[model samples]
Structures are given as C-alpha cells and as structure tokens.
Target chain A: MLSFTFWDILSNLLLAARWTVLLSLIAFVCGGVVGLLVLLARVSRSAVLRKLSGYYIEAFQGTPLLMQLFLIFFGLPLVGIEVTAWLAAVLALTLFTSAFLAEIWRGCVEAVPRGQWEASESLGMTYFEQMRHVVLPQALRISIPPTVGFSVQVIKGTALTSIIGFVEVTRAGTMITNATFQPFLVYGLVALIYFVLCFPLSFYAKRLERRLHVAR
Target chain B: MAYSFDFSAVFDYSDVLLQGILMTVQLTAVGTVFGVGLGIVGAAVMTSRSRILRVIVSAYVELIRNTPFLVQLFFIFFGLPALGFRLSAWEAASLAMVINLGAYSTEIIRAGIEATPKGQIEAGLSLGMNRVQVFRHIIISPAMQRIWPALSSQIVIVMLGSAVCSQIAAEELTYAANFIQSRNFRAFESYFVTTILYLALAIALRFVLKMVGNHMFKRRSHA
Candidate 1:
C-alpha cells in the first residue's frame, strides 16, 4: 500500500468527484427517460402494460440496488455477456432511479386532476392526445419540486456504485483512507463533498415546494 | 457454455443466514425504537421557542438528510475510532441508522405536529388544561396518529438501509451472503437466496407494522 499524503488523497477524491457527477447525470437522464415511459405505461389504458410496468417497478424497488449491481456486474458474465463496472453501475443506478422516478412522476401526473382529463376527453381527444396537450402541461409544473428532490436520492444512490469497483467519490475516499490510514479525514471530506453536491438540490426543492404552495 | 447452478451450497448455510436475518431484525428493532425517540425529541427541539435549538436541530436534519447513509456509516464506524471512540460494527451501524431515520422521522413528525390546528391547542387551554397536559393530550397523540404512516415507511427504509451495515462486516444478511459466496464461490446462488430472504423479511415487517398501527390507533382505523 502506498503511503498517501493529505494532498494526494484530496486530489484523488476530487478527480473521483467528476465520475460521481457524471454517473449521477447519466443515471438521472437515462432513468428519467425510462421512468417517463414506465409512468405512461403505468397509467395506460391497457391492463397488460400497467401490470408489466408495475412488476418492473416492484422488482426494482423491492430488491436492493447493491444486489441489482451485483447481479448485473457478476451474475451477467455467467450468461456470456461481458459488463464493465461502468455499464453495471449505470444500469443498476438507472433502473433504481427509474422505479423511484416513475412513482414520483406518476403521483405528479395523477395530480393533474380528473377535470382536465375529462375536459380533454369531451373535446374528442384520444388518451395520448389528452395527456400530451392538456394534462401533462399542468403536471409538469407540479412535478418540478419532487423531481428535484428525488434527484438528491439519485445522487446518493450513486454511492452504491462504488461497491462494484466503480471509482466514484466514495470509492476514492475508501482508497485514500486505506492508503493514508486516515478514515476520519477521508470520509469527512467524502461526506462534505456529497453534501456540497446534494444540498443545493435539496434547498431548491424545498424553495420550489414553498413557492408552489404559496402560488396555489 | 453450460454451468449447473448448485443451490444446495446456499441452502446448507441456512443457519448462518438465519443468524444474519435475526441480527438484521434486532438492528432494525433497536434502531427504530431509539431513532423514533430521537426523532420525536428532535422534532420538538426544532419547534421549540429557542432559535438556537431550532437551528441546531435543523442543521442536524439537513446534514443527515443530504448525505448518503453509506458515508455516514463509514464516518461513524471508521471515523469515530480515529477520534478515540472505538465502536463495534453493530454499534456504529445502529448509531448511523438512528441518525438517518431520526432526521427523516423528525421531518415527517414535524409536519404532523404542524398540521395540528391551532384551534385544538386553544380548545385544550380553554378547558383548563396545563401547558404540558394540553401538549400531551391535544398535540402529541393526534400528531402521532397523523404521522404514523410516514413514520412506518421511514422505519422500513431504516430496515432496508441496515444492509449498508454489511460494508463494515456487521454480519447482516448481505454480509452473510458475501461470506457464503466467498466460501462457496457461489455468488449467484447466495445472493439470490439473500434477495429472496430480504423480500420475505420486508413483507413480514410491513404486515407487522400495519397490524401494530391498526391496533395502536383506534381512531386512525376508522379514518
């Protein structure tokens, strides 16, 4: 083990912080897209699509992300597919985020009110057209605060990617702590970095919620 | 490209797995009890008359809420030892769970408390109730009933988060699976079994909480 200095550890952690941000962005974007699909399926007229999406959400939400990561990273190789740590981390985090985002967005979509849906339907709009033109516009405004709040969860969930050897912030901190034998300083900095990354989103989420509430 | 999956190896470790499950249950129980108590106190402190106390409690809530549980676990488990306070993996894990859940529960319970209409407190005061009596009789019970669902959900989250303890070798279900997989080199089988066991435990815990909630709050049942 190399004897790492404080400066060396700080530099490594800062470098790894880039990966953390990148992973969060990738997971959040991918999850948001997939989650939108799942949300649409969940609220679709077809029972089959709704049930399938429900199972997808339940399976992802019920099982731990660590297990999902392990299954993707280690269990997949058994089936002749080679998955890198990045692929596994992104896949696991994306699936995890999708389940939660689907649920959050579903709540927002449903909060668009029955009257709007009725009005769109009375105008001879199809389900898709109704959601596209009428309901979703209102829901988007209501969804902002919760979506931002859930992003904090997405960012925090990325820490679990470190378990699969993805050298993100937590993993870097672990490596530095192992080398420097300074768990306190290393993990403290890690926690501080995570807080710095997450706190603004959290504060903005709260501010948005308050502003929205006042507007209502 | 054919490999036979031998689940027997995983099943043979049932006793070890059970022990880990019990430890998880124990950890969840202890953490929930203490964490909920801390949450109640923290919520009260946050709503207290003293601005300093409110600020301190708000800081604690925000700090814990914003940070990941794994990092917090590492901080307590590994970081505290460096500060001359050595804690066992179980102690550190439980403490971290308490801190995490307490912050969340404080927020949930605070919302419940705030939702208690001012008229109810005034009504209690008008009925010749002392401040303490009024708070206990008018605010706490009703607030608890209102927040029980959110509190129970947070408790389940605490239970799920107990798996993070395994990172420090707390010997929970996940840790047990890790040990079994390393010993038997049956990673897939071991984790499959572990996942199923966790699912069962989560279901059982949810049922139990629902039953307990039903039993504890009579008015809530009607609502």
Candidate 2:
C-alpha cells in the first residue's frame, strides 16, 4: 500500500478540482440557455406555452436534484439510451438550472413594470422584438446579481454529480481519504477548494445586490 | 430491444421505502427546528455591535454557504472521529444538516432583520419598551414575517439536500432506494419509485410549511 503525503494528496485533489470547475461552467452556460427559452415561453402570449413551461419549471423545482441525477444516470440506460456519467450529470443539472434561472429571470422581467409591456405592444413591435430590444435589456441589468448568485449554486451542485461517479473534488476527496486514511485533512481541503471557488462570487453578488438596492 | 418496464421489485421493497420516508421526515423535521433556531440566534449575533462576534458569524455563514453540503457532512461524520469524537451516522447527519441550514437561514433571517424599518424599532423604543421587548415585539416577528417565504424555500432546499445523507448510510429515503436496487438489481425501477416519492415529499413539505407560515403570520397581517 502506498502512503500519501499531504502535498501529494493536495496536488492530486487540486488536479481534480479542474473537472469540478469545468462541469460547473458547462452546466451553468447550458442551463442559462435553456432557462432563457423557458423564460420566454413562460412569459409569452400563448397560454399553452405559458402553462407548459410553468409545469416544466415546477416539475424540476419540486424534485431533488439527487433524484434527477439518479434518474438520468440510471433510468436512461433502461430506455436504451446509455449515457456516460458526464453526459447524465450535465443533462440533469442543465434542466435543474433552467428551472431556477427561468424563474429568477422571469421575476426580473416582470419587475420591468406592466407599462413597459403595454408600451411595447402599442408600438406594434413583434413579441420577439419586444423582448430583444426592450424587456431583456432592462431585465438583464436586474438579472445579473441573482444570476451570479445562482452560479454559486451551480458550483455547489457539481458536488452532487460526484455521487453518480464523476470524480469532482468531493469524489476526489473520498478516494484520497480512503488512500491516505486521513478524512479530516482531505475533506477539509476539499471544502476549502469549494470555498475558494464560491466565496468571491457570493461577495460580488452581495455587492451587486446592495448597489441595486441603493439605486432603487 | 424494447424494454418492458417492471415495477414488481419496487413494490416488494415498499416497507423499506416507508421506513426510509419516516426517517427522512424525522431528520428533516429535527434539522429544520434546530436550524431555524440557530438562524434566529445567528442573525441576531450577526447584527450585534460586538465586532468580533459579528465577524465570526459572518465567516461561518460565508464558509458554510460557499462549500458543498456533502463535504461538510463527510467532515462531520468522518473528520470528527479522528479528532476524538465518534458520532453515529444519524447524529453526524443531523448535526451537519443543522449547521448547514443554520448558516443559510442566518443570512435569510439577517436580511429580514436589516429590512425592518428603523422607524419601527425607534417607535418601540420611544413607547417605553426595553431592548428585549422591542426586539421580541417589534423586530423579530415582523422580520420573520417579511422573510418567511425565503426561509421556507431554504428549509425545503435543506430537506432535499438531506438525500445526500444516504451516502453515509443514514437510512434516509435515498438509502432505501440504494438498498432496494442492490437487492433486486432494479436500479431504474427503484429510483423511479423513489423519485416520485421525493417529488411528493417536496410538494407536501412546501404545503405544510406554507400553512404553518400562514397560521403563524396571519395575525401579523398589516391590513
């Protein structure tokens, strides 16, 4: 059996942290796109789209992301669509992020005041034009803070993907502890890595929020 | 190959699933109670004039909030034993959940505290109310009223996060799912059943929490 030193363990876990960062970026970007589409449908003039997207958000929101990950990782194989852990993780997390981002973005959009919507309509602009030119520009400014805040969530969420067998930092921590027989030091480092990744975003999000609050 | 779905194996594990659900409910209930209590105290401490206490509370909130809950759980369960404290999986899970929930609800409740108008607190003070009286009567309850929805959502998120406790073999709902899958080799079917149960639990929890919030805060209605 090979005995691992603190530096060796830290260096190995540090390498694994890259995957965590990559997975979070992939999930956040993909989820952001899906969430925008959901936001559009959720706020559109068509009642059917509105209702369907509403349920879509609810179904994702009302379930645990752990369960979603299991279903995607385990359930898809049963249906003859075998997915790698990476693929399944991204799919489940993207849907999860879409739901939350859609909800948050919709709140910002609605906060643009009802008069903006009516004004855009009265200007005879198409629905897409209204959103592209008017609604999103204003809403995007308001959306930045919460959206950045949610990125912290997406980063934390990548930790759960480790359960399905993708070796992110937390999974790497477990494997290292088993090897080194030092759970305290290993898991503490794992947590510190996550803190390093997440705290700056949280602090910036708070600053943005306060700036917005002061502006309002 | 067209796969015909079979759920018979899942049904065979129904009793196990029920026990898992019971344990989950117990863990979540206890975690929420203690977590919210910590949140209340933490929020107060976060806002107090004692600069050291304030910095300590803020550091706790930032550190916990930034890290993943699973790592936190592993630290409590595995790390503590090395430091001369051995905890049962249940004890470790509960403590981790409580601490995690506490850090979160601290921020949420602190927001509510900050949102309390200065006029309201001043009014209480001018009306011959002491600090404690004004805090209890004029500040805390109203702040809770303002932040109830956020607090409720955080509570539910922690409930869902409890699913991770099964990793440490805490016998929660996900643990049951894992157990059934191991027995029947029906991973898909078992997880499907467990997923629906989780969805149902989340919905039921949200409803129950909302009702409790409504009942408690109804009399404080501004109108």
Candidate 3:
C-alpha cells in the first residue's frame, strides 16, 4: 500500500482544479453564444419563436442540472450518439448555462425603455438595426454586472459535471478521500477551492452593482 | 443499431418513485421551514448593531453562497463521521439543505431588512412600540413583501438542487431513478421520466410558494 502525503493530495487536487476551471470557461463561452441566439428568438416578433425559447428556458430552469446531465449521458446513446462523460457534461452544462444566461440577458434587454425602441424605429431603423445600435448598447451596459455575477453560477454549475464522472475538482476530492480516508480534509479543501474561485467574481459583481447604482 | 424505448419498464417501480417524491417533498418542506427560520435569525443578527456578529453572519452567507450545495452535502454526509458525529443520509441531506437555504435566505432577508426606511422605524418607535415590536409590526412584513418573489425563486432552486442528495443514498427522486435504471437497464427512460417529474414538481412548488407568499403578506399591501 502506497501511503500518500498531504502534499501529494494537495498537488493532485490542484491538478484536477484545472479541469474545473476549463469546464466553467467552456460552458460560459458556449452558453453565451447559444444564449444570445435564444435571447434574440425570445424577444423576436414571431410569437412562435418566442414561445419556443420561453419553453426552452422554463424546461432548463425548472429541472435539476443533474437530471439534464443524466439525460444527455444516457439519451444520446439511444439516438446512436456515443457519449462520454465529458461530452455529456459539457453539452448538458452548455444548455443549462444558455437558458439561464438567455433569461438574464432578456431582463437586461427589456430594461431598455420602450421609447428607445420607438425612437430608433422613427429614425427609420429596422428592428435589428434599432437593437444593434440603440437598445443593445444600453442593455449591454446595465447587463455587465449581473452577467458577471451569473458567471459565478456557471462556475458552480460545473460542479455537477463531477457526478457524471467528468473528474473535476469535486470528483477529484472524492477520489482523494477514498484513498486517504480524510474526507473532512479533502471536502473542506474542495469547498475552499470553490470559494476561492467564486468569491472574487461575486465580490466584483457586487462592487460593479454598487457602482451602477451610484451612477444611476 | 436503433434502440427501442421502454418507459413502461421504468413505470413498473411507481411505488418506489412515489416514495422518492414524498421524501423529496419532505426534505424541501423541512428545509424551507427551518431554513427560513434560521435565515430570519441570521438576518436579524446581520441588521443588529454588533459588528463582530454582523461580520460572522456575512462570512457565513458568503461561504455558503460561493460553494456548491453538493460539496456542502458531501461534507456533512461524509466528513462528519470522522469527528464522531455520525449522521444518517436523510439526516445529513436535510441538514445540508437547511444550512444551504439558510445562507441564501439570510442574504435575501437582510436585503429586504436593509431596504426599510428610517422614517418607518422612527414612526413605529413614535407609536410607543418597543424595538422588537417595531421590527415585528412595522419592519419585517413589508421587507418580506419586497423580497418574497426572489425568495420564492431561491426556494425553487434549492428544491431542484436537492436532487443531488441521491448521491449519498438518501433515497430521493434521483436515487429512485437510479435504482430503477440499474434494475431495468432503461437508463434513458428512467432519467427522462424522473426529469419530467422534477419539472412538474418545480412548477408546482413555485405556484404554491407564490400563493403562500401572497397569502402571508396579503394584508400588508392592502392596508
């Protein structure tokens, strides 16, 4: 039996944390792209598209991320799509992040006054032009803090991927605990790592929010 | 090869699923009740004049908010036994939920509490109400009203997040789904049905929470 030292455990956990950070970044970036499209459809003139996107958001929001991961993990194989845990985790998390980001950005977009839309329209600008030039620019400004804030959620959301055997920080912690029988230490470190990852983002978001409030 | 669907195999264990659903509801109910109570105390302390206590409560809120609930659950369920404080899965799961929600609600309720106008407190004091009376009669209700929607959403999020309790074998809905899938080898169908059940539960929970919030704070706005 090879006895592991504390440094060995810490170093291994640190290595695993890289995957956590990578997954979060990938999900956030991919989710942002998909979420933007969903937001456009959600706010578009077509009631059908709006309704479809609305359901998409509601479905994702209303269910647990774990279930979504499980579905993708299992459901894909049925459709002849071979799915690894990494593929399933990334796919489920991307969709989950997209729904939430779409909803958050929708609120920002709506915060732009109706008159701004009308004024842009009166200036002979089309809907897309009005959005691109006027509404979106303003919405973008107000959307920054909350959008940054939601990245914390995206980071936390990646933790669920561990259950599907994606071998991230939490999963690594579990593996280390089984080896060392020091679950208390391992899990406490896991929580601490997540806190370190998330707190700066949340703190900065709060600071941004306050600055926005003061600006207003 | 095209795979065949067999949702009926999953349905064969309806009794287990029902029990799992009941346990999930029980966990949420316990979590919401005690969690919100703990949150109120935390909020009150946060709003109090004690600087050290405020710092401590804020630290608790920040720590819980930053960490994932699954990690917290694992800590309580797996970690505590090392310290001679053994907890059953159900016990650990519910305790984790309470602590998780308590942290969130503390933050939520504190925001509501902070938004109360100084004039309103002064008015309540001028009415010969003691500080406690003022808080009860003049401060808390309106504060709760303002943050109720946010609180309700947080509650729904917590409920959905509780699905992870199955990992510790707490026999929640997800655990039941896993059990059925393992037995029947109908992984897709099992998870699919379980996910739909969760969606329905989430929807129903939100509706009930909205109704409860309205009913609890109805007279405040009307008066």
Candidate 4:
C-alpha cells in the first residue's frame, strides 16, 4: 500500500470532483433540453407523440440508472457504435435525468390553473403562444423548487458514471482507496465532498419550496 | 461496421440470470421490511417531543440523504472490512440498503404522521388511551395508510438501487449480467435481458406491495 498523506488524498479527490461537477452540468443541461422537448411532446395534442414520450419516460424511470449506464457503456460498442467512457456516462446520465425532469416540468406546466389556458384560448392564442406567454411563465415559478431538487439527484446520480470508468469523485476515491488501502479515510472524504456539493442545493430547494408554498 | 445481435448466448444463461433475479427480489424484500421499520422509528423520533432526539434524527436523515448510495455502500463494504468488521457482500449491500431506505422512509412517514388530525389524537386520548396506545391506534396506523403510496414508491426505488450492489460483487442481477457479458462478450444482449427482468420485477413488486397494503390497512381503504 502506498503511504499517502491527508492532503495528497484530498487534492486527488478534489481534482476528480471537477469531473463530477462537469458531468453534472453536461447531463443537467443536455437533459434539460431533451426533457423540455419531452415535456412538450407529452403535453402535445397528438396522441402518438404523447404516448411515445410517455413510454420513453416509463422506460427510463422504471429501469435502474446503473443498468442504463451499463447498456450504454458496454452494449453500444458491440453494435459498432464506439463510445468512450465519457460519452457513455454523459449519455446515460442525460437520458436518465431527462425522463425525471420531463415529468417534473410537465407537472409544473399542468399546474398552471386551467382558467389561464382558457383565457389564452379566448384571446385566440395558438397553443404555442399560450404556453410561451401564459402557461409557462406561471409554471416556471412552480417548477423551480422541484427542478432544483431534481438537480441534486442529478448531481448524486453522476456518481454512477464512475462504474463506466469515468473518473469522477467517487471513482477517484475508489482508486485512492485501492492504492492506499484506506477505504474509510478515502470514502469519508468522498462522502464529505459530495455533501458539500449537495447540501446547498438541498437547502435552496427547501427554501424555494417554502417560498412557493407561501406564494400560493 | 455492422454487427449482428446474438441473444442466444444470453438465453442459454437464463438459469444464472434467474438466480440473480431471485437474489435481487430477496434483497429488496428484506431491505424494505427492515428499512420501513427503521424509518418508522426514525420518523417517530424526529416527530417526538424530545429536542435531542429530533436533532439526532434530523442529522441522520440529512447525512444519509446528501450522500450517494454508492459511496455509502463502499463505506460499509470496503471501509468496515478494513476496520476488522468483515461482512459478506450480501450483508453489506442489505445494510446499506436498510440505511438508505430508512432515511427516505423517515421523511415520507413523518409527512404522513404530521397529516394526522389533532382531533383524532384527542379523541383517542379522551377514551383513556395511553400515549403508546394513542400512537399505535391513532397515529401510526393512519400515518402508514396515508403514506402507503409514497412508501411503496420508495421501496421500488430501493429495488432499483439494489443494482449498485454489483459494484461490491454481490452477485445480484446486475452482477450476473456483468459476469455473463464478460464471459460471452455479449454485453448488449446481457444487459437488455437484465433491464427487462428489472422492469418486470419492479412491476411485480409494486403489485404485491399494493395488495399487502390493501390487506394490512383495510380500515383505511378509503384512504
């Protein structure tokens, strides 16, 4: 076993944490884009579109994220689509986050009181126009807390990317632990780093939830 | 570069996959039962009048909630063994699941308990019931009923989360897939089968839990 000081282990783990943050950003942003499209499809008037999006959501949500990561990382290469660990990790995380976020934002959009839609319709507004002007504006407010909350999940979920060999905080900790044979020290720091990353989001989510509740 | 799919390799290993499925189901079942019990206690403690107990429960909840389960599992599986507390992979996985599930269950059950009306508690007390009696008769039963859906969903999440046990070589369904893929180099077919099995298991678990809840809380059927 390598003799490592506290600072040595921490510095390595911190470097790895950058990947965690980056992966979370990539996944969250990409998932947000895809999820918005999914939300739109879900709420669209076309039955086929809605059903397809519904199926997509159920498929991702019903299955394990670990399984999804495995399928992308290992399974894709077999079919001639060569993917690096980074590609597979980001793709899996994005796909998983999109399903949940789409559901969340859909609930938000649906929660915009029925009368608001009726009012927009009365003004001869198109569905897109109504959503852009009347429905989404209100929905955005209600969506903030849960969206932030879901982002925390997204951040935590990025840890699973480690299994695909994307060297994030958790993966780095694993490596360090193996090298140093200090599982407690290494993993404790890992958990602490994750706590630092996640707690603020949890606090902010709670604050937003309270504000949203009071606003209503 | 086009490659043809060969699923027969995976099909031939169906028995191994079945074993993995059974283990996953067993892990989920044991974990959910114990986890919910811990959750109820945690929730009760958090909701109790004792200030220190509330703080302890809140701290436990926050700590577990903020950390990833993979890390938590590593702490148990890898960390504890180094501390001279060697547990098998199955024990480590189940313990981690119990801890994770307990935290989530605490939150859900606490919500349910809080939703219990003051009048009902008062009525129970006025009928000469002690605190424990009132708690069991009026609070916990109704709280379980009120939170059954959320609790069941959390349990399903636990079932899915069990996939992480493969990292520790727990030989669960995902681990079986990993093994088969490594052996056969048929990754797509292996994981595809695993995913279908997981979906089927999740659906089955939800159905069974729904029936169990229905039978257990018949008095609150309207709930």
Candidate 5:
C-alpha cells in the first residue's frame, strides 16, 4: 500500500480547496442575482407574487439542503438534462442561496422604516421607482454585513456538494482519508481549513455589525 | 420528455419512513435539550468573570460556527474511532448535533445576555443574590425571553440539519428516503415526498417551539 505524507494530504486538499472557493463564488453571485428577483416578487405589489415567493422561500429554507441536492442530482436525469456534479451542485446551491438571501434581504428592506417608504410614495414615485431610488439604497447599506455573513453559509453549503461527488475540499478530504486511512488527521485538517476560510468573514461581519450599530 | 411519475413505489415502505422520521425526531429532541443546555452553560461561561473560560468558550463557538456541520459530524463519526472512542452512528450524530447547536446557541444566548441591562443585575445583587442566583433569576430568564425566537429558529435549523446524519448511516429521514429510492428506484418521488415531509416537520417544529417558548416565558413578563 502506498502511503501519503502529511504534505501530500495538505497539498492535495489545498488544490481541491480551489474548487470549493470557485463553487462558492459561483453560487454566491448567481444566487444574489436570483435572490434579488425573488426579493422583488416577495415584496411586490401583487398578492399572488408575494405568496408565491413566500412559498418559494419556505420550501427552500424549511428543508435540509442535502435533500434539495439529492433531488437535483437524482431528479435532473429524468427530465433529460445531462447531469454533472458541477451542474447539480451549482443549481442546488444557487436555489438554496437565493431563497435564504432573499429572505434575509427582505428583513433588511423591511427594517428601512415605514416613514421612508411613505415619503417616497408621497413624492408620487412609482413602486419600482421608490424601490430603485430610495428603499434599495438604504437597504443595501445595512444589507452588506449580513450578505457577507451569508457567504460563509454559502461556503459551508458547498461542503454538502461533496456528497454529490463534487471534487471540492470535503470530497478531497474523503478521498485522501480513504487512501491514507488517517481520517482523524485529514478531517481535522478539513475542519481547520474551513475555519480559516470562514473565521475572517465571520469576524469581519461582526465588526461591520458593530460599526453599524455604533454609527446609528 | 414524458416520464411517468410513480410515488406508489415509495409508499410501499411507509413503515421505514415512519421509523426514519421517529429517529430524526428523537435525534432532534435530544439535540435540542442537551444542545441548548450546553449553550446555556457556554453562554454563562462567556458572560462569567473568568477570562480563560471565556476565551475557551469563544474559541469553541468560533470553531464550530465556522466549520461545516457535515465535517464536524464526519469527524466525530469517523475520526473518533481512531482515537479509541468507538461510537455508534446514532451516538455520533446526536453528539455532533448537540455540539453544533451548542456553539450556535452559545453566541445567540450570549447576545441576549449582553443585552441585559446592567442595573437589573446590580439590583439582583443588591438584594443579596449571588452570581449563580443572579444568573438564574436576574439574567437567564429575561435573556431567554428576548432571544427565544432566535433560539427557536436555531433549533429548527439544527433539526433540518439532522438530515445529514443519514450519511453516517444513522437511519434518519433522509436515510429512509435513500433506502426507499434504492429499493424502488424512484429517486425523484422518494426525495420529493421526503422533502415535503421535511417542510411539514419544520413547520410543526416551529409551532411546537413557539408553544414551548410561550409557556416557559409567560411568567417572565409578569415577574
């Protein structure tokens, strides 16, 4: 049996970490776009749109993300779409991220004070105009910390994609563990790598939150 | 593409689904009780005067918070055996859930504790209460009242996260889904049904938490 050195494991895991980073960026960006649209529908003028988006958020948020990924990984083939782990992971994470980010941003938008909305409306601005010129800008300011924080969740969420055979950090750790039979060391390193990636973001988010509080 | 949908294949294993759901519920219930208990202790340590303990708690919180739950679960399930602690899948899953939720609720509860007005603690102390008494009477109840909703939401999230326990063969709801799908080859229908069940379970769990929070915290407002 060939043995893996610690360097081999670490270097290999780092290589796979790049995919984790890439997958996270893709999901976050795509999810942000989709989330914005869902946010519009969620807070739209029409009751049907609002209710539909509400269910959309509920469905995504209420279920475990693993189940969602399972459905995407297993369900897509029946509909004749060629399924790769990449496609399934991206699709599932995007939908999951969109639902959550929309909900979080909705809270931020609602927190923008009723008077601001009223003032914008009294200026005879259309709903979209009010949203575009007034509400979104204010919401966007307070939304930054939470949005950045949610990206940590996005990164963590990508770990689940490893189960779907995506060759990211977690999958790499599993593969290396199989080869090295050092699950304790490999998994510990995996956890440490994630902590390294996520702690700075969490710390920054907290710092930003504090600054916002102090500013207000 | 026209594919005939067959949910009947999945329904044939209703007993397995029920067993899986029961296991999931059992895991969640244990995790919630002990996890929140651990969080309370962790938060207490966090808000305590001991610097070393506080640092330790903070480190624990950050470590668990930043890492994926899947990794934590895997580490406990797969790694601990090498360290001479051979745990069953159920034990590892529940332990991981407790630890995971403990870290999250530590931060959540600490936020509530920090928000407690200093004057109230002084007042409790002035009435001859010790630190533990102050924590129990003057601090914890009101803090819990304030953060009950957040804590409840965290509990529900942990419950949903318990789905990952299936990976280690803990036989949770998702495990049932996987089993049914494997047997019937109805992956879509099985997962679809299981996802809906999760949705329903989430809603029910939220309702239950709301009721419990109301019952527990009702006296706090009057006191």
Candidate 6:
C-alpha cells in the first residue's frame, strides 16, 4: 500500500469538503424556497392547504433522512428511472430541510399576536396583503436565529448523503481510512472540518436568540 | 412499459425483519438509559461552579453537536481499535448512540435545570437538604417534569437516528433490510418495508412518550 502523507489526507479531505459545502448550500436554498411555500400553506385560510402542509411536515420530519435517501436511491430505479447519487441526495435533503424549516418559520409566524392580525383585517387588507404588510415582517426578525440554527442541522445532515455513495467529506474520510489504515486521524479531521463549518453559524444563532429575548 | 412492485420477497424474510426490529428496540432501550444518565452527569458538570468543568462540558457539547453522527460512529468503530481498545459492532453502535444522545440531552436537560427558579433551590437548602439531596430530590423531578416533552422527542430522534448504526453492521432494522435485499435482490421492497417500520416506530414512540409525560408532569406539592 502506498503511504499517504498527513498533508495528502488533509488536502484530499478538504477538496471533498467542497462538495459537502455545495450540497448543503443547494439543499438549504432549495429547501428554504419550498419551506416558505409550506409555511404559507400552513397559515393559509384554506383547511386543505393547512392540513396538507401539516402532513408534509410530519411525513418528512417524522422519518429518518437515511431511509428517505435510500428510498429515493433504490426505489427510483425500479420505475425505470436511474438517479445519480448527487441527484438522489439533493432530493432527500431538500425534502428533509423543507419540513424542518417550514415548522420553524411557522412557529415564528404564529408568534405574531392576534391583535396584529385583527388590525390588518380592519384596515381592509386581503389575506395576502395582511401577511405581506403586517405578519411576515414581524415574524422575520424572530425567525432568523432559529432559521440560522436549522442551517447548521442542514449542514450536518448533508453527511448522510455520503451513505448513498456520495463522496463528501465523510465518505472521503472512509475511503482514505481504507487506503491509509488511519481511521482515527482521518475521521477526526473530518469531524473538525464539519465543526469549522457549523460552529460559527451555531454561535451566531445563539447570539440572535439572545437578541430576540432582549427585544421581547 | 410498467413494472409491478413486489414485496413478497421481503415478506418471505419476515423472521429477519423481526430480529432486526427487536435488536433496534433493545439498542434504543440501553441507549436511552445510559444516554440519559450520561446527560445528567454532563449537565451537572456544565452547571457546576468549576470553570474547568464548564469549559470542558461546553466544548464536548459543541464538538458533538456540530458534527454528524455517522462520522462519530466511524471514528469509534474503526478508530478506537488502533488506539488499543477494540469494540464490536454492537458496542460501537451503542456507544456512538449513547454519546450522541448524551450530548443532545445534556443541553436539553441543562435548559431544564436552568429553568428552575433560584428560590426553589434556596427553599430546598433552607429545608436542611444536602446539596446532593437538593439536586436529586428537589431539582431532578420538576426539572424532568418540565422538559419531559423535549426529552421524549430527543429520545425518539435518537431512536430514529439509531437506524444509521446499521451502517456499522450492527444488525439493526436497516441492516436487515440490506441483508434481505442482498439475498432477494428486492432492494426497493426491502427498504420500503424497513422505512415503513421506522415510521411506525417513530409514531409509536411519540405516542408512548406522550403517555409517560402525562404521568411525569402531573403537579405534586413541592412540600
């Protein structure tokens, strides 16, 4: 077996970390877009939309993301559809993130007091107009910390995509460990890189939370 | 062209799936007990007066919380052997799970601990309860009572998360699905059954925990 230097392993893992970051960003952005729609549906006056979003959240959040990925990865091929690991991972993570982000945002939107809603209605605002002018603005401020906090979850979650043959940092670490027989060193470095990516967001989330409490 | 779905291959291996479900439930039971025990200790350390302990606890929480559980599992199962200690797949999986739950529950339980009003602790002290007694009797129950819902949900999350332990060949439910699929070549059917099993487990766990919380959260006289 050829020996890999410390730098060789670290550099290889760092390159793979790019995919990790990219996957997280794509999933986060996509999930955020879908999550907003779910949030709107959840708060809409239509019982069907509200209940539909509720089931959407429960289905995604209630199950493990690993199974979700596996289902998409294996199940799609049965219908004569082949999916690359990248596409499968994106599908799974986006659905998973949407459920969580929607729920978090829903909590914030609901936190806007009843008086605000009544006042908006009295001002001859339509449902969309009331949400746009009054409710969403107030909710946006409190929602930031939790939304940022959930982003850390999104980043960490991208690691599961590794199981489906995606060569993100975790998979790369496993591959390198196979090559170098240094699981401790390789996996330790992998964990550290994830921490580097997640900690700042987590810290900022906490700061935002504290600020929210003070504002309240 | 239409392909018909086949689940008969998976149902033929019902025994294996049953074994997998039992193993998963057993792992979660052991995991929940030890994990919650460790979380109580970690939370206590976090809140204790020692600056060194506070630093160590926060660092432990951050490091675990920020990283993925799968990597942590790999590190324990594959790494620790090189460091002189060897762990079986079951041990490694359980340890990984316990460690994961401990980190999460520490912060959760600490939030519960912190939510205890200062006057309550002082009241226990004035009643001549020792610090240990105060912590065990006065603090733990109400604190647990308050956070029972969050703690139970965390337990269920960990239960669901335990599916990843199958990656290490722990013979959990997901592992059974993999094994059955390999034998029958019915990958979709196998995983579909396994996924439904997990969803059922999560829902069942939530239901049971809600019942448990009802009993635990009942108001009792502080006296």
Candidate with top lDDT is 5
Candidate 6: C-alpha RMSD after superposition? 1.4
How accurate locally is residue B195 in candidate 3, as Cα lDDT from 0 to 100?
95
lDDT of 2 by residue, A1-216 (tens): 778888999999999999999999999999999999999999998999999999999888877889999989988888789799999989999999999999999999999988998899899999899999999999999999999999999999999999999998999999999888899899999999999999999999999998998998
Candidate 2 residue lDDT tens string, B1-223: 8877789989998999999999999999999999999999999998788999999999999999999899999999999899999999999999998999999999999999998889999999999999889889988998999999999889888988999999999999999999999999888899889988888998999999999999999987864
TM-scores of chain A, one for each prediction: 0.96, 0.97, 0.99, 0.98, 0.98, 0.98
Give the Cα lDDT of each candidate: 0.89, 0.93, 0.94, 0.92, 0.95, 0.92
Best by DockQ: 3
DockQ of each candidate, alpha-carbon based: 0.74, 0.85, 0.91, 0.79, 0.89, 0.84
TM-score for chain B of each model, two decimals: 0.96, 0.98, 0.98, 0.97, 0.98, 0.95
Report the lDDT tens digits of candidate 4 across residue range B71-172: 999999989877799999999999999999999999999999999999999999999999999889899998998899989988998899899999999989
TM-score of each: 0.97, 0.98, 0.99, 0.97, 0.99, 0.97
Clashing pairs in 4: none
Kindly report which residue stretches of model 5 are placed more than 4 angstroms away from their true locations once superposed.
Answer: none
Extract clashing residue pairs from model 3. Answer: none
Error of 5 at B120 (Å): 1.0
Tens-digit lDDT string for candidate 1 (A1-216): 457777888888999999999999999999999999999999899999999999898777666777788878878888888899999999888988888899888898888889898888999999889989998899899999999999999899889888889999999998888778899999999999999999999999999999999999
Q: Can you write out model 4's per-residue Cα lDDT over A1-216, one digit (the tens) per residue? A: 458999999999999999999999999999999999999999999999999999999889889999999888877787678899999999999999999999999999989889999999999999999989999899999999999998989989999989888999999999998799899899999999999999899989999999878977
Candidate 3 lDDT over residue span B1-223, tens digit each: 6888988999999999999999999999999999999998999999999999999999999999999999999999999899999999999999999999999999999999999999999998998999999888877888889999999999999999999999999999999999999999999999999999999999999999989988998787676
DockQ of 2: 0.85
Per-residue alpha-carbon lDDT of candidate 6 for residues B1-223, written as tens digits (9 for 90 to 100): 8877889989999999999999999999888899989999998888889999999989999999999989899989998898998999999999988899899989999999998889989999999999899999878888787788899989988898888898899999999999999999888889889988988888998898888777666566343
Give candidate 4 regions above 4 Å deviation.
none
Cα lDDT tens digits for candidate 5, A37-151: 9999998999999999999999999999999999999998998887999999999999999999999999999999999999999999999999999999999999999999999
